[model samples]
Target: MKQSRLPHRFGKERGRNKMDKFMDNPWFVRIVAMALALLLFLSIQDLGNKSEGSRPNGMESNEVETITAVPLEKYYDSENLVVTGMPDTIEVTIEGQRRFVEATKRQRDFTVYVDLSDLSIGNHRVPILYKDFSEKLKVKVEPVYVEVSIQEKVTQEFPVEPEFNNNILAEGFEAEQPIVEPNRVRITGGKETLEKISYVKASIDAKGLIEETIKRDTKVTVLDRDLNKLDVFVDPEYVTVTVPVNNPRKTVPIKIKQVGSPPDGTVIKRMEGDIEEVMIFGWTDNLQSVNEIEVEVDVSEVTKDVELDVPIKRPEGINKITPERVKVKIVTDKAKNAETNLSEVPIESKGLADSLDVEFLSPVDGAVSIKVVGNKDELKKAQEGDFEVFMNMQGLRVGDHEVNLEVKGPKDIKWELSTEKAKVRLKEKGTV
Candidate 1:
């Protein structure tokens, strides 16, 4: 019995020893601590994920957005009526679910407009309405109401004229009559406005203009008799205006030329041009060559004083000339012999070189006597001043020579020179 009791005691002690060894092992204790820590960390991470995944009850994600300058459409009777005083655009703000708000902002899926179809003529307040947006979005417009005025329609015809700033034109430049295509225009407006209409004109700016014809699409404006601008609708709002501009200008005398001789027994006593001078426009180079405007007159059958209308002949390179026609007066009388002798008809030496000096040797008084024969009436009006006698010394050397003299006078008159040739001597200007 004692031996069996001893063995039992030993076995109990061995078990006890084994339990202590396991509790005292550092690796085992470290492993148990690591496992417990991992479990606690996983539990906290799960709770965090759940909190992030779900939201509180009765809560949702929403966003707010704003859109600016949204255009407003108008619905009204535009044909027979005119509406005014309405905002062209407005601003809208929307607040809704995030997805819906983002979609609304991206697509801008909405409509803003004012409906005036049911409204009648005169002033009225109309509410600005909007539609076509998602139900989840809250829309707000900046201007909730708009004031509009409607007027009756009436039509009237008015002549269209062109207007521009004349002061802005270049110097020495002028504009001719401005031709507006579609000379007339129809204006539709209120009755009172139509009655106030005085003239319709298209305005253009002539600033810095260098073109010959100014062509542009211009807006038409209505004006009252007082020259104040009026508001009205004009059909065919624009018309083409052709303004001819030029810089060539000259004022010159008119010369009369005879086409046919006078009657057999009658002679032209005197021919005169009714218009003293005329204004002409052309290129600068062309204007420099034009000194006078000429017109031809026929006196073949005239036996008395007659007034004739002659068309002015336009020269090449000339654009326009004032006074399309000129009047000519021709006086005629019976042919008769009449002689007029003058003493002061100076003899001019022409074609002399600048370095040469010429002296007349034949005419002692430096003048010649010219005898002209014509009708008594014509000869009475003729004077020595009318005749010019010139001597040609174009190629003469520094020596004495005889130069022939040429006489100029009216075609109907006969002239006689006291001497056909004049004795002239050429010498160096400073030497003699």
Candidate 2:
């Protein structure tokens, strides 16, 4: 390389080096100078067309408007809203050119919703938010500072009643009075909404209620007087109605069943039992014809102590038992043979209610084989007049009945009678 004296440049080479440095700093030198020139020119010009003192871009001198917030009468509060009632739409006359008006009209109609929904229950003041507009623009409002009076919502409880349609109760069945478990419901809403509410109705789907006791869960529906459903709350979401229906009482004649057999050496002197009666209440078809009732006595392997336990029974058709267990005292003694006549004995009918008719069958006239165990002196002194057998037909209507004859004798004497089976026929007063 030729000797370079302190990096000296000349002619075309120097020009090329200078050009490269200028290109590197092109933005500052070119862009900045142009921007400054444009700014200076704009500053010198007036903001008006040459022909008139109006805006240069066909805009008015005053181009901005301020609109105030208008409150509303309601029980609710909201943050943002587009108000209604002034008109379906709002028209704005802008001072700007047609293009500006067209563009800003859409942008200018912005909403400043002062939510009354959340405000306190009393009157409140709220500010409206405006966007992209300067104080130069004038805002004309249909209604200003809308008198916003927020009323507090109220809650109330209403009773729900069942609505029955053409459904008829089943035959021999009647509609029971409808009783609601929780008759009332709580409704919470705005005061206006509460005022609009009319009544509450409980939905009763009788579609499945087939005439018997109808027990079901139903929903309580709040409705306006027009029967239109309303938005409300119920303290109890649902209510249950229990309807009790009554038909007729079914009577079943009770039958007596012997459970235990007497010991071999000792025989049953006289077996006696009263047929029990049971009245059942149920659906008509289920309780129609009750034939008899029977009771069961468990006397498994009972001997010597000789206490016989007997159970009275009603007809099998009757399912329920009025008297589950009745206490009966059975006496057992050594078998002895003695002849006794019914003539001298004071006939006794005990345990018979006043409404019964009694009759005597066997041992009424002739001598009966009286078997007993006691001191020889007591046996000798015992008279036929001291013993008696009577069958109760009192309160007994027309029917064929077999009653066990109860033998009444001196409590002090250890005597037993050997006749237990007695037959009696009873008829109604007028009937033969």
Candidate 3:
């Protein structure tokens, strides 16, 4: 058995030696290495395929994002059909691979719209639709549907009125008829909406108190009679509004008013102001009510003939009084200065309440005798008609009150009242 096994072992060793020689050969080594490499490559490809197949449709893990305020659009016959009651915006949510979700959110190149083309003039409920986005994204919108109104479109030409802020005018200025470059506007809207149109106006832009004429580019606005805003499209959406500002002027006489009494025994013979008339600047409406401006002069300490400078006070609604100061010459003397009485001067009420009546409690007759002193000859010519006596009851109420008396008389005459103050009672009308 040993002898037989030795021959077999010898033969096996010889075969192994042959096999080792074959393995040592470069061509044989190259072929075997290639075969092993091919097997490894094939195995790797199979494993890769299996790994990829394990995933659903070879997609990566999913991600989600929400996009807000996506604008909603409509498709309709805009020339003839007007649609309303559609949401201006909607929210869109998308879920997909992380890369796609991020890209879709970043790009935001999508449109959410409603189809109104097939619908007639009426209300309809429709589903919101979207396009221009990646198909791989699972997109969902917050508002899936909208109800809209369709109406027959109508267009009409309406006169465009110009609206201005009169408060913006300068103190002495007035606004003229505003001129619009295109005085009329063409508005397009639903027939029913157009029927409700009441005003189409362009508001002039006034940055400040306007002193001169100006032209401004202003947008057009449409509204109903109640001033509620109406939705419509106006052709030539902007127009130039020409606002002409007029500064009216007038020349009026200036009156020198005397306050306070002169020295004892002294009487004013003549009071003259160098500024006889002044040019006034103000609105035309205000100028209509003014005929003269007054400047007060005090002659309490004036003893002899003298000249003095007095400042001018601009009355209400008078923008400017030219020559704010003036020279007044006062002549006073004791000669021919005698006081005379103007009797039974009836009292007049000023600034009294419309719902109340007043009674002079002290002078029950509401009459007073005043002493007028001038060049005695002039005093003879003065009468009760030349004087007006009253008290300011503007802020007085129902009560017993003592109020000072005010007198308006000839400029040259000095008047002394019988009483400096009068007691009065204010009671509501139609009462005892």
Tell me the whole-model lDDT of each prediction, alpha carbons only: 0.81, 0.53, 0.87
lDDT of the structure predicted as candidate 2 = 0.53
My TM-score estimates for the predictions, one after another, are: 0.44, 0.27, 0.64
lDDT of 1 at 33: 99
Worst 10 residues of 2 by lDDT: 79-88
Best TM-score among the predictions, by candidate number: 3
Indicate the TM-score of model 2. 0.27
Per residue, candidate 1 scores C-alpha lDDT tens digits across 122-228 of 98998899999987677888888988877777898889988866666564466777778877888888766787887788887756745366777788888899988
The sequence of per-residue lDDT tens digits that candidate 2 reaches over residues 14-116 is 8898888887796868987899999887766744344455535534434543323333233343222212222222223335444444455655544434345
What lDDT score goes with residue 245 in model 2? Answer: 55
Could you give the C-alpha RMSD of every candidate to the true structure, in order shown? Answer: 16.4, 19.7, 11.5
